[model samples]
Target: MDKYKQYFLKNIRKKLEEWETVPSISHNEVYRFLHSIAGTASIIGFDEIGSKARKLMNQLNETDDKQWTIEEVKQYLFEIIEWFDENKKDAPVSFTDKGNKYGDKPVILLIDDDTSFLMYMKEQLEKVGWYVAAIANPQKAITSFYDVRPDCVVIDIHMKETDGFAVLEFLKEKLKQQFIPTIMVSVDSSKAVRIKSYEMGADDFIQKPFDLDEFIVRVKRQLERKKHIDEMLLLDELTHVYNRKYLKQAYALLQSDWQRSQEPFCLAVLDLDHFKQVNDRYGHLVGDVVLREFARFLKQGTRVSDIIVRFGGEEFVILFPKTRREEASEVVNRLREQFECHSFREGGTAFSRTFSCGVVEITDANEPLEHWLRLADNALYEAKENGRNRVVSATPSQEAVHQKIIKIAVVDDDPIMRTIITDIVTKLPCERKTKHELQTFKDGVEFIASNWHREHSPCLVILDGVMPKMDGLEVLQWIRQQKRSDRYKVIMLTSRRSENDIARALELGADDYITKPFKLLELEARICQMMKRMS
Candidate 1:
């Protein structure tokens, strides 16, 4: 038997013997001891022993009096001992070993009221290459959790100020963003405590007088599991590049640098050309290898400070910090040349591959991250349009020109309203080189019948909600039913300010609802917001 099982058998017998003769031993004391046993037994997979002890613990806890009779305590203890004796022959010797699988040095937060025990465990863990922080107070441990930033936590369930269960609850609230392995330890071998601890998200449970070797092994195992889980959350499994989650974190940091230092950076969107054909011709397994190798190439080609992320399948994004537009373009083009000349293989069958890239420099401090991403995406779309296997760069000016060439359509039965909306759009501040045009329609029916969307689709459509025949809502619905309805932003102009009409217009995919006689500046501001989103 492992040291944990041996220790539990020895201690439970002593506790039961004491309970039989000691009437002063309160039900709380007996229950606490039994609860610890139940938890430890369960952790070591001695299910029968754990269940019996748990049943007895619950019975004691449910008693009307806080004290248990000597006979009652004896009966409970006997049942648990009988279960343990019966299962002792079949019980597994030890828990599975999961240490040394990962190279990281784990930082462990050790919280126990017993100062001597906490210090001893800390010393032993540190001796075995763990970074250990020992705390004798539960409250102190709870408050210092973020500062310590330990990979895992170990807390005694029977602390003075507060129990480990309370610490778990408090720690959970504080560390809501990420998972941290927590183990509960105590001398009281009771099933109720084990159940409560597990319910509160305790990762593991151990009884007192744990074997030092096994204790260190269990701690290392938890750390290993945590490392595995964290990698799964933050890494792309196939390519091993930082996943989108990590990308967001990195972007936040980089954005802070940009705001503080006005740092120059560029975003590049890369797509493997004809990647689908790779899967179709050579099989998905080979396609996976190609993706992995391509990711390796990207990692090798980029600077250490550059952030490479597997944005999605066959697509990757690289954030080039402190790099200018022309420099970024040159760097990516060199990678493109190398990738084009490289040969990928599957089962000794070699095939050539190429990639297309689009890069956009971060120029506007006020522009949102999505705007920069969209700019790079638009450049990528252009690269694909102009043929693949090349690198294309987009400056802020070029992006603004491409995104802000607003073609607007104004539709209303009243020619006056149509002209009023058209004139408003024409008066907006725009670049002199911009191809801003206003198309006028007498009614929704006339607007829907025209091939306006086919040639130079309008960025925004000003549609009167209540028009004669094929009303604004109907036209909006028809426009939404077309392919890529999201490409067109429609503002519903309604004279009626009823809640139901506005809600219906919004439900039918009107981007904005403007009641009649709206402020000119408010309308203009909303249009500017839409332009920002478009950019």
Candidate 2:
């Protein structure tokens, strides 16, 4: 037996001797001595020492009313101690064989002041092929702890200068690390002490006179918990894709190389078509399942290098590093097809989901990073307008034909309304020839500022009524004031059915007014009629 183990056994013997002579044994002193032996035995994996200590303590409690003679108490203590000695030797040999089978595991730091207990623990732990750095002083633990980042730490509550709680606080603050499980072993069985140890971030605690099996089990549990936490941090809780946080971190690393090499890259923004309807009709649970399955389809369809992030609800974004626009289109098409074919089942009801995507390639040094993102968003808007469940890509040369084509600007703050108009225009016969090209803007200011010049003016302007920045009536007034109102066909699309608003639009040179939720065919017919008049 190592010195600490021998010392622990000697102290137990001393306690038994003292109890034999004393008229009444102090329960506190008995607890402290037994706890020291149990803790030492547990550290060395000597299960019997800790177990017998617990049994003896329980026996003492049971016989508290009876006045026990010294001989009776001595006999009981000796039986417990002898049982532990025999088990200690046998258990270590068995544990040693098991340890060899697993090979040498990582080192663990054992901090306590009791030299006899520490030596005993070191011997038992070393026998099992676990390298241990046993320290008596809590003050010296900090330097030693940093020198070796042990897989786990076993700390005792009672030390010379500082207690276990102080040592734990020091470790937490000084190391600047959390989640390192510290098991605090002490004889103070007070509830307050245990609570304080936990508040200081101790993973587990052993009362003085601990059970060996319980101590080992607590240590293993803490280690397992830490491993589980590490895995959860990498995963997205909603769609289970690599989360946006992880994507941003990965993007920063990959972007530099791609930029330096002038390698092509593509970004795609994907949105579920009329997803709110799914939640309203089938409920959010079904919608959630559809999202998860759709995300899975995206993952399976893309290359390993491709990163997918759930960019909030009903929307997802993908980064395809070192991939061109055409390559990205193929991936997006595959994902779309897969999502379309797959069915989501919830509560015995099955439904199909479709999504629209916009893809843009990383190009141009002059444009900001947000521009590429906006381009994809614009293409996604185009896809929604061209009809849902479709893919759209921005062609660079489309801007060059802004003048030659009959430029039609559709401005609406309402996404659905904008989508409806874009769909109607893209499906029109004139759109096939690219002669009636379409441009969309969120508000009047953006449209006016970009296309106000006569050379790049729109042939038709569809404006929404209520908007921020500037309202449609203000935009119409500005257009009429320019004396170029006669040159363009203006249509006011409004949710308001007020006769005064209609008359005001007409007086402001608007050719027509289309109401909300108008029939798709009727809107198409109106555009055709307006185009014919312009011709």
Candidate 3:
């Protein structure tokens, strides 16, 4: 495929050279040539070239046959020709990961309107183990900032859709109380641009076409500072885990994720049993020691994805993402047994301590984020009432499972993608043991305006990011302004691999985001996983 692109580019160059040697040419001929190239480039997945060709074609008269000088022809095709000549030596675009797993890496949000620059910069950043969320649309940058919570931000000043300063200004205001590092980048190296960037709250400013190594190092420096800031503000001083101050933000993040995927989680509240007696018998210093040791124990007992927060005094809260109630209960019971068997020693004195816990799974996803914690607290009260050293499970909602109508919407301009998604939605009913009413729309506008889409039922949207009318992101943002629930899920199906695009979709309330050319089995598994937590 790469060789084919190279061959075509070489053919284009040959054509251009042949035209230049000729005495004259017709405007209509040039238009026809550009039209052919536009279609061919698009077919070959060279979207940038296709777009350039189309734009140039619009300036040419299809019926003009007057002789055009070689100079005039060169001037007409100058920009695209220069672009082609410059990028001809570059490697083909790669969708493969190059064996680099960036899923767990520090995310850097790069906002630039140049598609080629976005692609190049993203690959370069990923090579250094940082995940780059390239936002080609500057208008979408601000909305994505909070969702991705990037360690570093890089914004290009010049853009077609929106001003980088405006985007930066919005984000700076949103993060005025926070310490996320933001860097402004532009081809302009003037003192004014630099000073204005800093004035707009940019932590750093770099000129475009600068050393890639230097850019990455500056990003690393910013991330290091962010880490230090997190240690001081986000972590509990004694336990080193998250503190109560960060719990509300964490809960909001978790709730946003749940709204996107209907993925369930468990919240557990734990209290040291007979903690007052411990302070009376062993003194405050020993009690503090026990608290610290118990925090370490809790951390060891839970998975890395789980969060433990020191709520207050001897009380601690645990949040388990994507965990079921029963599984969370079992984990808490095991941890309690192990903790009870451990001996706490101060000098020659030794004693055993126990903790009571309550675990609750979010059965109603639409409830307030604090509702889960409150339920878990109630269960903890039950644990204390029954036995001081035991884990009690919160009774789940007793609503009977009745036959319900699940509306499934597949919105994509591409017929093949729509067919694939509709098929998947069709299969989900049998696999999930539920009934589904499915609908397909070839355009975002059609789907949004359709009567079927307005039906009052639990809906699952398999939306394409790129569409003819309203884009998938726009539709997603619109849908999110309405409602959310355990039965409502929106999985974004897009060909865009940009993390900024993904974040914007999520920040706008998308339940899930799937890139193009994804495996059928993997998508099916994800849907299954989310569905199991729904009801």
Candidate 4:
């Protein structure tokens, strides 16, 4: 045994001898001596000495000092001192305090009845960049959970006040949403003890006399697991952008910032042009590559403060805090141009794709998120109708700009088709008309039911054929049957298989037709032609 261990044992033996000589020892003195022996013996791995000391303390608790006989007390003390003499285990080297190694180190809450062991562990852990709060009482450890918010907890399973399982349950209950990883250490190595600890929310269990290196590794592992789990919840696995869940959380935080300053921020929704066709043409694996590259470009193009989220599939949403609508428009339009110019290659074959965006500014905190999203969606739809590869502003310019607002309607049964055409329309530029009004519908019946003819009649209608109720043909026939069929300008969208349908619609007075999967630029050219003819 080390000299310090031998010295401690001799001091304990001296105290016991003093008790033997006294006619009757007080309960307080018995407790003081037994508690010291229990703490020191446990630290030095003298298990029998620690257990015997605890039993003597328990005996002291059961009766007052007047009831105890001198013979009985001396007999108990003799066994404890003799056991310590026979045990030959050396005390581990005491941990030396190395002051403040880390600036913001992880906090560890260590709870044990043994004060000596608690102090030793605290010193060792502090040397390895851990801020340990050592609590000798289990009751105090339970109450400290809120204050510490520790990264990890180390508890001795056999505590005087309460067991480690009770402490684990208390911590788990208090930390409902997140928890501090707990390690329960005990001299008992039975299977039942480990199983009960795990069932009670213990992250790990260590037998007494554990290697310091192994203990540190287990603590580090739990901390790493917590970090990785947090990241997984916030990040998109495929695109590495923030997912929708994170976006919602960020919005709540940003909303608080907006409430303080009332500063305007822009929300933009982006959709790639003909993304479905890309997947169909080059398989889903190539489609994944395209989406990843697209997200990378978005991140590279935007400012660091901007929040980019892969909303779902090929659609994404960007939030530009403390930016005006016009500034956001300029930023996104520049990116849109870059996207148009870049080529995506797969298997030695090159393909190009473009995305359209709708930008809206939130100037009022009273406006709900859903309303803002709707306005952005409307602008995006208009971009698709006018032309793809463009940016449109939902926040209209000041009236002093003298910009005429164009009204356009898209009637398509296919939701994806509606989104595509709206994105195209949003890109249309009218230096004369700075903002455009756009509406979309699933079927022709709903469009006609709106009775848009009188006050806010659309200047152009991009109608889809082969709809469920009231197809594009029926809508055209209804328009022709009216008194002024020429008053409405219509561009029909049809598939290659619907050539006969297009012919019939043309004879029925449809203005023009574009085949499905048509080039976005081609659609823009046809819109220009229709505008010229109408003028």
User: Against the true structure, whose TM-score is highest?
Assistant: 3
Off by over 4 Å in 3: 1-105, 113-116, 119-140, 158-166, 173-176, 195-201, 224-535
- Model 1 clash count equals 12
Residue lDDT tens for model 3, 118-152: 75676577557665666666655664453455778
| Candidate whose lDDT is highest | 3
The lDDT of each candidate is: 0.70, 0.65, 0.72, 0.70
Query: Per-residue CA lDDT of candidate 2, range 1-535, in tens?
Result: 2443444455555566677677865444554345444434543345656667755654555223455566655675786756745644433432221222111344567887775576556556654445555666576565446434566788888777877777777676432232466778889979998998888877777897866666666766766776676555755665778766575665665567676887878888899998866866775456666777888888888888788988766788898888889989988988888778877676787778899998988765345555666677767777887888999886653232211267777877544446656766776665211367677888888888884336543478888765667878888888778754555667776543234555566545555556443444445555665554343
Root-mean-square deviation (CA) per prediction? 28.8, 34.9, 17.3, 33.3
- The order by descending lDDT is 3, 4, 1, 2
Candidate 4 segments exceeding 4 Å error:
1-232, 396-535
lDDT of 1 by residue, 53-84 (tens): 66676565433446778776656587776766
lDDT string, candidate 4, 341-385, tens digits: 899888898989999998999888566776677678778877887
Q: List where candidate 2 sits over 4 angstroms from the true fold.
A: 1-234, 365-367, 396-535
Q: How close is candidate 4 to the true structure, as a TM-score?
A: 0.34
* TM-scores for all predictions: 0.36, 0.33, 0.39, 0.34
Q: Which stretches of candidate 1 lie over 4 Å from their true place?
A: 1-300, 305-330, 337-385, 392-406, 427-436, 455-458, 497-499
TM-score of 3: 0.39
